[model samples]
Target: MDFEELYQDIVLDHSRRPRNFGELAEAQFHAHGDNPNCGDEVTVHLKLGANDAIDALTFTGNGCSICMASASLMTLKMKHKSRAESGELIHAFHDMLTAEQESEPDKRLGDLRVFQSVRRFPQRVKCATLPWHALEEALGKPAGGEVSFSEDTAG
Candidate 1:
């Protein structure tokens, strides 16, 4: 199969059998993000090690396929990474999701390229970005004072 086929399969598989799909009963950091336009909401929970590495990451919420799958993938990728590394990955992924053709893509996103096509759909951008933004907040970034976005509003 080609890249598109593989990407579709991954997206569908994650959507149907999402990894990290539940809550963390004892999370050190908790952050929630919402896409009001599509009604996608997710709460990410993380536990950091003494060195600020990600000891654990989990999420619980309701959202579109893209939002949930992205969260699943994000947690999967975050395991064992230092907080700083996780922040870098978050930045790279954000650039990938928000970039226009003129912007350079981050190769580290790998299979996440599936969402690149999503950029074309302005309405879905929030769906694709919700997880990354939530992750950023969970990592203790300023995140510009709690992110709330709607297709109808500035967000």
Candidate 2:
């Protein structure tokens, strides 16, 4: 199959049967993010291991295919990553989606690169990024986790 077909299949598969789609009872960090424009909502749960490595992560939410797929792929990519590494990935992802000049997907993004095309659709960019913003919020603070994004605020 062609690359476009493969990418679509991967996205569809993840959206239909998202990985790590649940809650964590003993999570050290958790945060919720919502997009007011499209009504996408997601909560990210994270458990850190030795030296702030990501021990486990999951997400719970309802959104469009792009959002669900992104959450799924992000959970898979973040397994066992350090907090610093995850932060880098978050920045790379944001840059990939918002860059004024399109470029090849960053190698660091792994399977999450499937969403590269999302940048072309400005509206869908928010859908794909809602879960990521939630993840970022969970990592940014120690308590009282919540984040909200609108078309005006989200890049």
Candidate 3:
């Protein structure tokens, strides 16, 4: 099968049976993010080990298949990575999913590379990124997180 087909299968599988898909009762760090435009909301919980590695991570919420699958894959991929490494990964993933042109993904991104297709639809980008933003906040108490300004024009 072509890579897009395989990636689509991966997304479907992860969304239907998400890994680390529930709460983390022993979590040491946690945060929630919402994309009101798309109604994608997620809460990320993390437990850190010594030396700042992520010992465990999980999340809970509802949204599109892409959002759920992204959260699932994120938890799987970040299991033993240091917080610093996760931060780098966040930037890489954001860049990959938001790039305007078709581009090769970083090999280090592993299954995360599947999300490269998300770059095509600007609206869906927020669905795929909501959990990630929460994860950044979870990791950001020590490292400042970036502010995502909404376009709401209310005074």
Best by lDDT: 2
RMSD of each: 3.8, 2.8, 4.1
Q: Compared with the true structure, what per-residue lDDT tens digits does model 3 show for residues 1-155? A: 34364359899999999999888878887787777676677888888898889999999988889899999999999999997899988988988987666678778789889888777666677778878888888887664333333322221
Would you give me the overall lDDT of model 3?
Answer: 0.81
Best by TM-score: 2
Give the Å error, residue 8, model 3.
0.7
Clash number for candidate 2: 0
Q: Estimate each model's TM-score.
A: 0.83, 0.88, 0.86
Order of the predicted models by TM-score, top scorer first: 2, 3, 1
Q: Write the per-residue lDDT of candidate 1 for residues 87-150, one digit (tens) a residue.
A: 7888888777676653656777777767776666666778877877877777874332233333
After superposition of all CA atoms, the RMSD between model 1 and the true structure is: 3.8
Ranking 1 against 2 by lDDT, winner: 2
**On residues 47-111, what C-alpha lDDT tens digit does candidate 2 reach at each position?**
88878889999999899988999999999999999988999999899888888888987899988
Relative to the true structure, candidate 2 reaches a TM of 0.88
Question: In model 3, what is the error at residue 66, expressed in angstroms?
Answer: 0.5
Q: List lDDT for all candidates, in order.
A: 0.74, 0.83, 0.81
